[model samples]
Target: MSGILETQQLTHIFPNGKAAIQEINLSIKGGEFVIIAGPNGSGKTVLIRHFNGLFLPTKGKVLLEGEPITKDLTEARKKIGLIFQNSDSQIVGQTVADDVAFGPENLNLSRKEVDHRVKESLEAVGLSDLANQQPHTLSGGQKKKLTVAGVLAMNPQIIVFDEPFTGLDYPGVLQVLKQIVGLHKNGHTIILVTHELEKTLAHAGRLIIMEKGRIVRDGEPSQLINEVELYGIRRPYGQNRSVETMTWLS
Candidate 1:
């Protein structure tokens, strides 16, 4: 897989003159499952927002397929779908089916095409049976899956999940983790941001640890697993287990 998403000297500064992310360069190849972990205030969220053009860079540029993302914000967003940490914030439609259809509808797709996407997306996430149910009535894990289905409906090539497993119970975490792994296995590039590594580390091909406003480490999970605690992320392995066994899924 070639480089599908990239950042060049990317930096984002808030209105108060605080730089959330400093000059950082990164690349994400197609179909790679990457885990980005960091402590609070490490700029993980700010960095991923630039990928979808949600937050423009303050100093440099973000590129999608070798072209600047700013060149076409619409195309950038369509190809790079973002699932926010809070599922409630992403829920807008009165029902599950309507919420999943929102993205395709906003793109002005034909009614037939929108219906097709909604059906396929929901099926992909195992929410087809709940199509007519209210989104608020779903559980936390189900809500996360709903967000994933919404993003899938957009036909995104790269999916950026920000703290996907947060606020989930044991079963909920497993449910969402299975959905994420399924997405990666089906050839969608996955960039997952979270401080909790044990829950999903085993499935990631690469690991990136961010500190303060810069990328402190980037490489294979096993190579950097030992050093994650230095940056305030808990080490998930012990003598009985290794990086490959650090996941919650069986």
Candidate 2:
């Protein structure tokens, strides 16, 4: 079956002549929750960046609905909203509402439409009350939610989150995790990248493990959960708990 988004033999080499990712063929169907996990330097970030044309492939190509993403980078990005690991980096406006409106505003949307999107997106992430607050004043978790809101405002069919839980307290993790699961439940295809599988493994339908710039394993999360430790991602299970119980929400 063709994927809503796909990468064929995707490879990327940095200017230093090092291949960050190599021969990564991936297919992501609509409404699927996929987790890409690996230790640091495993090319997880590089791979997702290509999904929306953030970084062009050194080899192969990225397809959105079977058409090259390069053919219309703008449209591809609108369909594939990426929430970066560092939320602060994605922030731009002085206020939370303004920040979320940035993407829609760039699309030349009418003021009413932009306001509508910003309002809906902020509410989706539970940040409606903080719309007038300065972004820099938000907590780590709130900042993450703000980024998600920013992406959500773009009305992307797919959302890619890169190391979303990097630095967050227990409450922060729970907040972000709930938002992610809610997005999936609401019919958004989710592509999440993180080595901390214990926080979200149970929620994912598929798990893809990467090593040395290539995918080493891809299958059902339960089937691959035991093998993640082999690729340097800490196994989220033990004798007492199973993959189904490996979520921060519980």
Candidate 1 CA-lDDT value: 0.93
Residue 128 accuracy (lDDT) in model 2: 98
Poorest 10 consecutive residues by lDDT, candidate 1: 237-246
lDDT of 2 by residue, 1-250 (tens): 9999999999999999999999999999999999998889999999999989889999999999999999999999999999999999999999999999999999999999999999999989999999999999999999999999999999999999999988899899999999999999999999999888888888999999999999999999878876777888887757557888777774
lDDT, candidate 1, residue 7? Answer: 91
User: Which 10 consecutive residues of model 2 have the lowest summed lDDT?
Assistant: 235-244
| lDDT tens readout by residue for model 1, 41-139 | 999999999998889888999989999989999999999999999999999999999999999999999999999999999999999999999999999
Candidate 1 matches the true fold with a TM-score of: 0.98
Judging by lDDT against the true structure, name the best candidate.
1
Q: Which RMSD values do the candidates have, in order?
A: 1.1, 0.9
What candidate 1 gets wrong by more than 4 Å, as runs, is none
Q: Positional deviation of 170 in candidate 1, in angstroms?
A: 0.7
> Which runs of model 2 end up more than 4 angstroms from their true locations?
none
